[model samples]
Target: MDTPFEIFLSAPPGLEPLLLQEVTEAGFAAPEVAQGGVTIQGDWPDIWRANLTLRGASRVLVRFAQFRAFHLAQLDKRATKLDWGAVLPAGAECRVDVTCRNSKIYHDRAARARVAGAIESFGGKVSPEGSLRIMVRIEDDLVTFSMDTSGELLHRRGYKEATGKAPLRETLAALFLRQAGYAGDVPVVDPMCGSGTFVIEAARWAAGMAPGAERSFGFEALPSFDADAFAAMKAEAATRRDTDLRFYGSDRDDGAIRGAEANAARGHVADLCQFTRAAVSDLPRPEGRPGLVMVNPPYGARIGNRKLLFGLYGAFGAVLQERFHGWRLGMVTSDGGLAKATGLKLSAGPPVAFGGLTVKLYQAQL
Candidate 1:
C-alpha cells in the first residue's frame, strides 16, 4: 500500500487529452495521457482519490505489477509469487479478465485460468460473477496486472435513473462540457435536454459538488482500503460554494422534461436548474446575462427524417442566433450536414465514440 504504482484513469477514446487536462487540474501527480486513458504515479490513497474525484474518467485501474512470461507455466509461476493477500482481501471473490496481444501466451482463457488458479492458491476466490475485478494484459510476452477500482461505471452517479433514447453518458457529458469551455461560472441551457444530462452536469459543476460525492467505489472491497482515511479525504474535499448562476433546459417531449426534472432533483440541483417542456423554436433564454447554450439535438442516426432534422437544426440555430445574443453554443451530433444546417460557426472537436457511433463537439460564439 505504501509503494507507488501506476494509477490509470480510463477515458473515452478521442477524449483522452480532455481527460488528461481534467486530471491535471484535479492535482493528480504527474498525469500523463495514455492510449485510452490517463496514467498517474500513486499508491492506494491516490487510487482511492482518483476514483473519488475524476469526472472525465470512466474507471480507475491500479496497476500493481508487471512481469515477463514466455509461456503459460512461467506466467503461472510468476503469478503465484505475487503477494495478492497484501492487496486483495483474503477469500475475496474476484473475476479475472485477460487479454493477449502479440504474446507467446496468446490464449486469453488459458491465461485467465492460470491467473485464477494462482489467486485461488492464495486463498482468494475467482468466480465468474464477482464484485472485484482483476484485469490482465499480456502484450509481447509481458504481463501487466491491474484491478478495477471502480465497480459500476463512474457515469452512474447514483442518479439519473430515467433516460430518453440515446442519452449522453454523464462522464462524456462532463468532458464535453469541459471541452466547450464551461468553467462552472456561467449559466448553461440545453434545448433538447434528454434526461437533463448536460444541464444537470452543468448545475452540479456550478454548485461545486464532486462528481463522486454520492457514490461508493469498488476500492472499498480491497484489503488495503482504509475507511477512516477515505472518509476524511472525502470530508476535506467537500465543497458547496454558493453561486448566482442558474442552469436551464427545455424539451419538446413532455415525458423527457419530466424525466429531466426528476434527474435534477435526484442530483441535488433542482433549485438551481429549471426544466420545461418546449420545442426548439420555443426555447427561451433565461432572464440574465447571456451564457452558453449546450445541446445534443436529434441527429439523423438517432431519430427523425434527414429533411426534418435539417429543418429542426436550422430553426434551432435561428432561435439561438436571433434571441440569445452574446451567448456561446455547443452541440453534439454525428452528422455534419445537420450541424451545418444550424448555421452556427461551430468548429468541430475530435470525434468521440459514444453508444456505437462517433460524435463530435461543435462549438462557437453565438
Candidate 2:
C-alpha cells in the first residue's frame, strides 16, 4: 500500500466547516478543519478524486515535506537532499513561491532562489509562467513545502464563459447552498440571478454531477499520475440521476438572461434549469414545492447607490413575504445594513471573504 500524504483542501475563509462537512461526506479520511482549509491524509488517487469531486474547495495542495532550517546555508543544503523528483517530473517546468515570517530566512526572494536552485539541480526547469507551482512557507523557523495540485483555482469549472457584473464564484455558491441546508432534493430560485450561478449550481447538485467533470486538473501533470486509473475513476464518478424538480433564475437584464441560458446549456443542466428576463418585482413562484431562494444582489460598494439599493431590497422582501409561502431565503451582501433593509428577520452567518470584500449570508424562512 502506498503511504498516505497530507492533503490540504482550501476554501474561502470563514467557510472551513462547510468544506469539512463536504470532505467528510465524500469519504476522505478523517478531515480536520484548519485555520485556512481542511487537512486530510490520503494517497495520490485520493488527491485526484478530491480535485475531481470536491465542489467547495478553492484549491487542493499536497504537503510534500517539512524541515527546520536555522539559516540560508542550512536551507539550501536541506532543500537539495529532499526527493523532488518523486512528485515533479524531471523535465517539467515548475514555479516556486516562498513566504517567510518569524524565521532566519526573512528574505522571500532569497528563499525562493535557494529552493528554485535545488529544484533545478534535481533536473526540473524553473519558469515564472509555469503551470506547476511549488509553495514554501517559513514560519517560526519551521519550513513547510507544499505543491499546488490544482493549477487554476477549482472554481474555474470551464463552463461559465460569460458573466454579469460582480459575478459570484461557483465554489462560494456551492458553500452558500450548503449553508442554506440545500440537499439537492428541492427546488431553488434566484430572483436577481446574474449569470445563473446559484440556479445552475443547484441543478448540477440535484443531478449528482461532479463540478470538475468538464475540466482538467493539475494532478494530471504529476510524475506519478496514472491516466488509465484516472479514466476509470472518472467513469465511476459519472452521475445519471433523474430529477423531477427544476431550478429557476431571473434577471432584469436581457443579456444576463441569455448568458445564463448559455451557461446552463454548456454545463449540461439546461433541462434541469430555466432562466428568464424578469425583474425582482415581477418574479413569480415557479410551479413546485417551495424550496430555497438564494440571491447575490449587487453590493453598494461594488455597484449602484446604497440608498437606492435599500428600496430594491425592501421590495424584494415584500414580494417574497406576500407571495412565496413556505420558502427559505439566503442573500449574500457586504453590508448588513442593506440586508436588514429587506425587512425580513434574517439570521446572519459568519462573514466570508469574497473578491476583497467581506460578505455574509443572511438567511431566513419566509
**Candidate that scores best on lDDT:** 2
The CA-based lDDT of model 1 is what? 0.90
Clashing pairs in 2: none
Runs in model 1 deviating more than 4 A are: none
Could you tell me which residue pairs clash in candidate 1? none
For candidate 2, lDDT tens digit of each residue in 232-300?
A: 888766564789989999999999999999999999999998998888999898876889999999888
**Cα shift from native, residue 147, model 1 (Å):** 0.2
lDDT of 1 at 3: 72
lDDT (0 to 1) per candidate = 0.90, 0.91
Show model 2 residue runs off by greater than 4 Å: none
Q: Tell me the alpha-carbon RMSD of every candidate.
A: 1.3, 1.3
